[model samples]
Target: MAVPFSHRLDWSIATNRLAQALTLHRPQFDLTASNPTNAGIDYPAGLLNAFQDPRSLHYNPDPRGIESARAALNLGPHTLLAASTSEAYSWLFKLLCNPGDAILVPRPSYPLFEFLARLESVEVIQYSLRYAEGWWLDYDSLERQLTPNTRAILFVNPNNPTGNYLKIAELHRLAALCAGNNIALISDEVFADYPLTGDQTRATTLGDNGECLSFVLGGLSKTAGLPQMKAAWLTASGPGAGEAAKRLELIADTYLSVATPVQYALPTLLKHGAKIREQIQDRTRANLGTLQNSHLRPLRVEGGWYAIIPTPRTRGEEEWAIHLLENERTLTQPGYFYDFESDGWLVLSLLTPEADFAAGIAAIHRAFTA
Candidate 1:
């Protein structure tokens, strides 16, 4: 008999299989591409030379990361480093929850939370982000979802696919709620730097949040458009933050997974990374405008590198995606991929080169209108 594997490792979705098979058969104009390196932005030549620092050749390990790199974030002594935001999530899960304890995640946000939580034997409860003119947290539903076993609440600032930031008022309310309920807040702010609209009311970062215990996650992945470098930070704040930091330090010590060269290269990468960040912001903005001006209707996006286009309800999201792929050679992510509350939504990455984005938009338009 074969050894049994963890139930968490036992799943694969049919849509991914279909997409892979289709791509293997023919070329696809893939609008679902989110990787910055594949997005055709002009990264500065020799930008990675910072990793060559002679200091990195010497082995020095710090549980909270090397001083220079942590200092580069300017987030004070509360910050800890991880190889990636995914790893940061794993560490936070371990730090915050015991087996079968729960965390609250936002619906219509990135689908990563469930997988990350499951791996740690933590249950994921979802709160709603309702959409009408814009996306806002359904606080009533959020409160209703809370249980005594809930240890933390995770939300993406300017959420993936949905592209809506947590408003300042919402943050205040969330802080109050978490404080009252004794739940920790985990804010994923990787895309906070890429606002697509001039929204002054959005909460930009949770690094200084003091109403309750909080963890603010960010990294070069979205901030500097350098995902390959593998550097991410977690900032702890709010009441009992010092204690939280100490515990997180112990968790980080076990891994010390961050590469030495990347830690040393962080300052240089962040300083010179401004140009790359600008390029990404510009690319996303231009593509968003193109999408807005097209015949298709897209939800209002406040920030992030993705936009949601609502397709015809006559067909399901996956069917529409498969239709476009088969007929127009265009690829899109079905709403189910992000666990959207309803049907008729398809997600597109705004990081595609301008011309290709436009072409894919036209193709989508053609597929639907025909």
Candidate 2:
């Protein structure tokens, strides 16, 4: 007897030798550190006290996660938690789609969603974001991509690596479009709190958007910078949300992947999460200033942890990334890695340590001005 392995499992590349070298003792400034734990940020005092609490010893497990934890999220009356956002995506895929159903994703965005969809045996449809004044959805292309098999359209609020968010007006339009097409609007708001702008219209979250069947996802990973805690949730709202949430809970009952410790700690963790976010924001804002002193033009980001910078069209993006590593001892993400529409673009993580980030930015400045 043979176990059939899926082709999707074979997909990822090594995360570059520079990252490996940094792990070994090589002197390098990695500007792609997205993990807040690794980015040298300080969390609030006494946060660790929640972890070893006596309450975690109880074996009480709820399929939708512990009630208090889910309630703490305040997303809605309907909520489900998972090991991480990836698991949340998988649960949602199973909840909404048949094996071959497709979901629309944004280009020039993080590559993780494509892999997540593939793992669920779901197809991904690409919809482009035009970078005119700033990154905005291409409505014509979006309209053209929907088909009978399209079950949902996903948006990364303040999208990964590109940082632009869905505007309130755009949300209204998209929700109406989804309502018309019978598609669910899935908003991944992991980066929702890190808005680069103070304008609330551009920084809106999708939890309360009532026009469509909406599933808003987020967790401790981005919210509290605690990926190791393995706590994430999905919230449902809109027409038939009550029934859909019940079905989702039944699916979640099978996996029940969240740990009791993390569940019990949710209250304290979310409370202290604000300080961690503040530290991260301070670093990203300061580094954003340092990153702009060079010839490369930085794209306008309304919010999120990553920044996209434009480079000159001299070589392949990978070759430029290689040059940065070899010559400057600095590492950056090649634009193509994020499915960028063209070359001459690179992504920098605002979560990087300020000194290291500044050094990497200075190196880019040297290359541009040289």
Candidate 3:
């Protein structure tokens, strides 16, 4: 008899044809990459010498992670270190949800979320983030998506691709939503450290809120732009947080996945990481200025490293992306890829090298006008 695979991983290969086509084609101006290393930003390497600490040679593993490293991340007395935010999310799913339980995610957000939920045999319901003057949560639609099976509500503060922040009002509403519901609130704040608009609140973290069981996640991936280091963490706080922390501690301990060198050097990486983060933020501001000066008039990005431009749609969104790729040799992501409810939207990375981003914008302009 043949072995069977799980149905959860079964997904359509055809939906990714545009991406696959561009990959096989000649080198194109890639606007889809958010990876900071390739974004042509300079980083401070002096702090990396901390990894040479002789103590790293000793295998010291803790289920809750090293206290000093957790302190470096601002995760307070209780912290669970994971190899990455991706792994942290996986752990959260394992800790909170049983098979077939559901979680609420944002629509017009990153597509990776649904895949992440699926990996844990968890269902995902997407709530719309209505964009007007700025993006705000569509609470009515969100309430409709919630059910008894819903174990948690996840927010990508300064969400990926759209770059929308969870404002104070939205945070208040969410806190109330989770209050007395016995539900967890997970805020993926990896991009929280990057705010395009000057935010009144400095890095709004959800873990400290005493309303519900909340988790605020971040890492060196975006905060420090060190993807290779593989360091990330989540801070669990709020009511019943202590109990959940114990369970999550056990789950994290089972893997103890983070490397000793990264854990030992996290403090230095973060200290120097701030310098690179500023560089990247400046680059994002410059690109935003370029967009503002042009006819594109991108949607106001409150925070995060990506921006979206609503374009005239002569054709379907997918057709537009393919046209931009084939005609302009400029690769861009279609808005629908993020579960956007509308058409005529193209997403671009602010992290693209300055000149390359300008050229991609020029190409897009030409294609749209031509």
**Candidate 3 structure quality by residue, lDDT tens digits, 1-370:** 8999898888776747687767766536877768898878787757669799888999989878787888777766667888999999999999999999999999989788888899999999989899898888899999899899999999998898778888776787788788857789999999988888877743377667767889888888999999989999888888878888899888988898999888889888988998999999898888888777777879978888888998785787778788888888888888988988988888988888887788888888888788
Worst 10 residues of 1 by lDDT: 9-18
Backbone clashes in model 3, listed as residue pairs: none
- Against the true structure, candidate 3 reaches a TM-score of 0.96
Candidate 1 has an lDDT of 0.90
Clashes in each model (backbone N, CA, C under 3 Å)? 0, 0, 0
| Runs with alpha carbons beyond 4 Å of true place in candidate 2 | 1-4, 10-27
Residue by residue across 1-370, what tens digits does model 1's lDDT show? 9988898665575557446758555636888879999888788888879988999889889999999999889987799999999999999999899999999999988888888899999999999999989999999999999999999999899899899999999999999999999999999999989999988788987657669999999999999999999999999998888999999899998878999999999999998789999998999999999999998889999999999999998888888888888788888889888899888999999998888889999999998888
Model 2 residue-pair collision total? 0
Specify the highest-lDDT model's number.
Answer: 1
**Ranking of all predicted structures according to TM-score, beginning with the best and ending with the worst:** 1, 3, 2
**Residue 355, candidate 3: alpha-carbon lDDT:** 79
Q: Which tens-of-lDDT digit does each residue in 1-370 have in candidate 2?
A: 8998778687767776545545654438888788788878887779988898798888988898898887788777888888998999998999889999999999978798889999988999999887986899887889899999999999999887778888888898999999999999999999887887777667378766778999999989888888888889988999879998899888888877888998989988999998888887788888777766655678887788888888777767777777787778888888888898888888998888988988888897787566
